[model samples]
Target: MEAFVQSKREDTAKEPSLFLLPEWMEADKRLTAGFTGRGGGVSAEPWTGLNIGLHVGDDEEAVILNRKRVTEALGWPFEAWTCTEQVHGSRVAQVTLAERGKGRERMDDTIAGCDALMTDVPGVLLTSFYADCVPLYFYAPEAGAVALAHAGWRGTVGGIAARTAEAMASAYGVRPDQILAAIGPSIGDCCYEVDGLVVTEVDRVMDELKLPEGERESCMQRKKNGKASLNLKELNRQIMIKAGILPSRIELTTWCTGCRTDLFYSYRVEGGKTGRMASWIGLQER
Candidate 1:
């Protein structure tokens, strides 16, 4: 139930410490997950410092070194890290030991083709990159299973988080109640504005939009103007609740990438010119 926050230091000479969720607080022996803020790593300038997204135009060697730093910070072997190409779709990939190093071989690996990844194998780090889009992490200690998902507005409306949870349950026998979720840093409600298309898609997936007593009309009315402010974090939280996870088990980082330009990357802030931050999870080998 405790939370830890690590701020980035201006100097790189200090040992890079990736944020971590305390094991005692989490009460889960088999799972570990955290979001990597913009600090750490070797990329410079636009992709300066710990930029993990390979396709973001950073030098290949810098990106490789950044990944190595991240893996080392997490106490994971460099070769055990697994990430996919995220297409903002609802597809989820199942990872096994045999599949290790499949996605990291080259930037063009199939990992980018899948938006979500799940695995029960220890030492296999499952990761997804993001800027403003929400990154969802799931862990089922009893089943020794974990998953990472990339949820943009489209994927959110498509119920990607819920689908990933269901997949973990079906594939690994993880009970929804036993699953612990961490909704990582992303664009918060303060900055996320959408159009009618997004609202309609959200309504289609969510049973009813429950607004504050006097805010119902205003909430729906904004959609008609072709632009409406949406709370993506809250929206995804609702999706998790509907999937049967308890509200208490979910932890949300209030840091908004769009708001904190210096600490994290944001597509909204940089306008397609920004690098990406990463959220990663894996089980340590016994």
Candidate 2:
């Protein structure tokens, strides 16, 4: 589908109800974004509570209600959320005016084969599910746009975060410097060990982009066993920087999913049999 430029005003807010909301951006009533930790949902064991992922073997009804609770907590109408079927690719979907209610009644239709979703439409929440994959959020207040991306090794190697940022810039006329990014909790460098193939791919991308020599090595440091420990959060942060976003405009969470089992579900720690956490961003209605 062809992407069109849109005009709107953007602001951001975050909640502090035990959720990992950003303190610096919580005062604005026009933007809402947060990650639901492993608490406050209705799924039973394995899935536990506050599991917002419907495809992760959680009870469908419970997932629905949990989604509702999250929306209600944000004071947004429950029907305004928009999510997608995330394929670990670099594709970014630009949400338009017509897709406002897709989150409630046509979720399946909204499940495009993409890793990122962006919108300038106010009150339309954009969401993505992640276990070990990094959840990245983008906002350009001056352009009135926001985007959410799920970046696993595949997506990272494919440059999904950069693609999402580029989409926002192209579609909303947002300067890279004006974009604010958040690197949410994920499998940190302390726990994410990868094979040589991943190391090679990451190196190849870094070389192709001519990323800073020190930054690249810092993200792909090796462990004693020769297996490289990948810092996805740092890699993605570099992606944003390469895309022209200023360092001061980015915020990162120090929580590691693999380490904080009580707060987040980690696919690596749980052998792929774990619930997924939801990371979302949206513009509130004026």
Top model number, lDDT: 2
Provide the overall lDDT of each model, using Cα atoms, as 2-decimal numbers.
0.77, 0.78
Q: What is candidate 2's lDDT per residue for 195-214, written digit by digit as tens?
A: 87898898888886687778
Looking at candidate 1, the ten consecutive residues that score lowest on lDDT are 212-221
Clashes of each: 4, 4
Candidate 2: give the clashing pairs: 12-31, 13-31, 41-49, 41-50
TM-score for all models, in order of appearance: 0.89, 0.89
In model 1, which residue pairs have backbone atoms overlapping below 3 Å? 84-111, 84-112, 85-111, 85-112
**Model 2's TM-score against the true structure:** 0.89
lDDT by residue (1-286, candidate 1, tens digit) is 3343663546544345355666422675656677777776677887877788888888888877777877776667878878888888888889988877655646776465779999999889887788899999888888888899999998887888889999998899988899988888888767778776787776566545353544333323354557777767777877887888898888877778889877788998788787777788888877
Candidate 2 error regions (>4 Å): 1-20, 103-107
- Candidate 1's TM-score: 0.89
